[model samples]
Target: MLTYQSSQDISITPTKGQDKPWLLLLLCCFWLIPGLVGHDPWKPDENVSMAIISYFMRHSDWTVASIAGVPQFSQAPLYFWVATLFVNALSWFGVAAHDAARLSTGFWMAVGLWGVGLAGRELFGRRNGRLSVVILLGCLGLPLWGHHISPAVVLLAGFAWYVYALALALKQPLRAGVLLACVFIVLLTGASWADALFAVLFAIFLFVFPQWRKFSYLITLITAILIAIPIAALWGYSLKANSSELFQTWWRYYAWGPFGGARSFAVGTSVGFLPTLLIWFAWPALPLAAWSVYLFRKELWQPHWQLLISALFFKSLFIMLATQQSEALVLPLLVPLVLLASGGVDELRRGAAAALNWFSLVTLGLAALVIWLIWIGLVTGMPLTLVDYFARFSPADVHWKGWGFVFALLVTLVWGRVLFRKQPLGRRALTNWTSGLTLVIGLLVGLFQTWIDVGKSYRPVAESLSAFMDGKHAQCIDVSTIAKDPTAALVYFTDLALDARPDNECLFVIRQTASKESATPEVLWSGHRLGDQKEIFSLYRR
Candidate 1:
């Protein structure tokens, strides 16, 4: 049941608290763009996403995502579509296509910050909105996901927008247009219909509670449904017309697919990994969110409380039921958790606030120190033990960039100011903590951009294997039983389509083996091993 308060209700009225928009903008700019601009696509999700976008850009299809001409129906088309636009846009400025695609992810992070701030301001005070942005940026997993081009990034933005719209709708039922638009955006941006449908159902459910069932509320809800149908239908109609196979496949995979297995939901529903993982994964927000809920335990029916609880419950349930419990599945919880946590910022005890600040300073300080140590080790080859340890990993193509160091130094100064400045134990403490966190992250990323890129990138692997190609085209080689990462690496690096064959009418066949002895194949082709002993990729040529 929903408890609806009139627009005149003082309990729900927002207070005008101190909000430093410039400070928020600076933090977001730093947090959002670090590890974004110049990194190569990494393994698993990033490379796969990049591959799909590459395909669409080359083929000019906005309605579907494909990899090496094969439709990857597991994901929706929105992310790739948006990234393609960025790819084209950045090309004018001479940025690499894949790198440009990552810029869009940074943009999404900025949008998410705005959405969080807007939502918080509507439901709580301006101070809460500002705190929410910092809390979200401080999320442990955000730095990893926020800088990459993934469906999860779009979903993050869409979730924030949806929540902001929900807050607006609660205050003025006529403002449901914004909520409806947000729902459509979520669906359009690759979220499953379950989420969009949930938004509509939740809106209607809002009206069912209390005296909120006014004509305006009903009209808003109905209008939302009306708007959603045609938009979805239009996309479906275009999709069906463009590629009937894709249209059917999208529904089959998303709508009719089986829910998550026991293994997928085991940690989520079980007590072992999730609790420990969430401690750090959700970070400061998780603690504050719990405290906020405890504070409002008796007021769960109010719009602010009800919206978060309902959304989190359904999303968590979905995750529990999902056939694969993915990190992406947990992304929806980020904003709701932040919203809930925002409610408790003012209520946090002074001692607790001080502890949080100290915790952030120590944690980020140690992390930054470690990054600096590694950079020094890479540059000077100091400490024989450190050099030996690094020797195990591939040597990153390191070069000294003066500007990078200067920027890091500047950020370090800012972090110092935030830590030493005399600020009160309310939002400023939280802001300084998160600001320091973002600064540290930005400094590390700025200084180690190339090192990070080279360490994780597949470009080196592709370059290494190119020698064995003997000046032959990528199509000249056929791949058999190669893992997904290396396979995608070859395709992206070589800019060639791979042939999946046991024996092919090609110059060479690439095979992955466990050890040197097992590397030899029974086939009649001459085998030459290419990759390191860790990941053996043998090239068999006729």
Candidate 2:
């Protein structure tokens, strides 16, 4: 029979061959912080969020979140609040507006990792805690969404803090007040009322287990509510005072709105599809976490399991039931999932461990290799097929960066060494998996960032539209109506207030009309078609 020992039996100290936690952490930073810094805020969330921050910077108003002059109620001001600080602070160093704003995500991403490590340590031990952070670094969804300047990413940080602070409520009961303060911060920083509600529910669920029904735990939760409500009320009062219309709009649209679409609900209801989703969505961590939960079936009563499951339950419930089912919704679940996955790392069998190692070595190794090949093809057209393929999509003016190649090559070399190194099954395998994942992410960022920028950025379209407006000397433009992408791009490129709603005073109007119809409004004296007949945009002088 397979036997298991307590985490106390394992050596927390790293041997010479093993990947040190600090180095693993540094590698994660390399994977996370690099591309996020230099890139423009790519559409849909990044640009939208950054635009709001830019608006706040120009106007210096925290009471209402907006883009251009349009008040946006979909998100809370907390994300923009933090991002605005970076936007102004980094401006001194000559960072671009979007790049400076995105600094918030980088800072919070690090906090999320630190919180994951702490939760793991509190639940398991120091060794598992470090390993848990590694596992989180290797998660499939993080690289895509973790760096987003959206409220969802900020919610992720708040969720991580909630997990860490909750663990503290039981372990260090004397610091209940401190833990409660963290809970208050979560409510204040979260994107929506739903997120704050989930946190409260998560706290209550922790005390549901008989063993955790202590006076300190109860008092901490009660205090958390008392602390959180007043803080939330203060923001609410300010919002109401500054813009009552926005306050009502937020309450009516989002506060208690029925959430989730057919696709998202399908994930919750359909047993058949969930496994498929989990396979790619949660990936290596989900499988290992499932295995760990199965092995520790009798120990589900523990506070760690209780808290993780509670958080997972509420977050998943919201994702499945909400009106919009974005992949970004999965961000909040990563911390608890990583902590649970770390529990199974030590109990993993030799064959299973070997399988994981080989999987990482092949899959991530191949991914890195492909990214390198593409990067080379982009720089030099020796491989005519890849060159032709890329030329069809990206501009012919794309240039090679010598520094990108050097950085990518160095990271790939380190990845190769980790892959080939002979080491024991558990922690070594986990660390290598994270290192491989980081290397692949690094390759994409270092090599393909500009390429990605070409496709995703709205700057070109924005610039094209701006060219039509240059001679007119219009102070502000009016968008009769436009989609999200074009609207955001116009705001950034034009550097003018765009009114989408009906207004009589605008000197110029940009509208998206039917292909057969002229984009020009009838009331305008004259208009200029922004693009060719195939494209839809017209700048009209009223």
Query: Against the true structure, candidate 1 has what lDDT?
Result: 0.69
1-542 in candidate 2: lDDT tens per residue? 01124553445355666645566666777777767766666767777776677678878568886665677766667777888889889889998878876677888788877777777877776566677788888888788776677767776777777787887887575475566566566555556666676677767776667867889788888777776787777777987898787777766665542342222222234333334566787877898888888988997777677777777777666666555556666677777788788888877888999888878778877887787777767677767887777765555334565676677788888776766645457767787878888888777777777767766666766776656456664567777566665676667656655776565467777667555353334534222222223335556666
Question: RMSDs, each prediction?
Answer: 4.6, 4.5
Clashing pairs in 1: 259-323, 260-321, 260-322, 260-323
* lDDT (C-alpha) at residue 278 in model 2: 60
Cα error of candidate 2 at position 335, Å: 1.8
Q: What is the lDDT of residue 376 in candidate 2?
A: 67
The pairs that clash in candidate 2 are 259-321, 259-322, 259-323, 260-322, 260-323
Q: Can you write out model 1's per-residue Cα lDDT over 357-468, one digit (the tens) per residue?
A: 7777777788877877777776787776887776555456444566677777778777777666444565556777687678778767777776656566777667767654
Candidate 1: which stretches are off by over 4 Å?
1-19, 255-276, 397-400, 466-477, 500-508, 515-533
